[model samples]
Target: MRNEKKKSFYQEFEVFSKRTATSPFQHQFCLLAPNEEVAMVMAQENFMRREPVADIWVVNRKHIRTLHPEEKRMLARIDNKDYRTTKGYGYLRKKWRQYEQKMLDEKEILSWGGDKK
Candidate 1:
């Protein structure tokens, strides 16, 4: 049938793009296309018209491997990441004070050139 043939012609694709070179690629949207070439063109025309796009990637949905909700529970828990944060090094403030030196916090680092201290 004509409907069945049309359905077979199109496949689902996941679109990802980034606005800047240093930024991570983020998912834009999903679309149906006959092939990767058409998917790229379609994405370019549809999304590129809205805002700036640094890079674009079109991937077939079938090609991507993802973990199901139940499988996610089997993954290791890594919530303890305070060591990577400024607050985790709070003890350093006391150490620096002993030497009469200031320990620059996040607030001071961010406000470097805004106002004169």
Candidate 2:
């Protein structure tokens, strides 16, 4: 005989919420509940009683799929490309100094945007 009561007790529910208008739904934690109604009620006082929660969702864990540990290992790469940044243009500083001119680096360029008419 299938134990319906035991099956319902161990159901894993994933909790999520959106903090604000611009924010995406983020996973807060997991809980065990039989159905969405119970999970939704428990999620409030259980996880976000003291904080602001604009929205919430309770989803069965079995409904979600995620990547494996081995799949994440394929994202590694070496950082040998210094030529893509200002660090690669350090020689320009010395050349500008030889011509009696200040090196107009990032700081000087960004400051130009301050309080313009």
Per-residue lDDT tens digits for candidate 2, residues 1-117, read 368868857789999988886789999999888788888888987867768878888898999987789977776656677788889999988887865544456568889889966
Q: Number of backbone collisions per candidate, in order?
A: 0, 0
Q: With candidate 2 superimposed using the best TM-score fit, by how many Å does residue 34's alpha carbon deviate from the native?
A: 1.2
lDDT of 1 at 35: 99
Candidate 2 lDDT: 0.82
- Per-candidate TM equals 0.60, 0.52
Predicted model with the maximum TM-score: 1
Error of 1 at 57 (Å): 0.5
| C-alpha lDDT (0 to 100) for residue 42 of candidate 2 | 89
Q: Which one wins on lDDT? A: 1
Q: Where does candidate 1 stray beyond 4 Å?
A: 68-70, 76-117
* Candidate 1 lDDT tens digits, 2-93: 99998899999999999988999999999999999999999999999999989999999999999998999889666888889899999988
Q: Once model 1 is optimally superposed onto the true structure by TM-score, how far is the C-alpha of residue 51 displaced, in angstroms?
A: 0.4
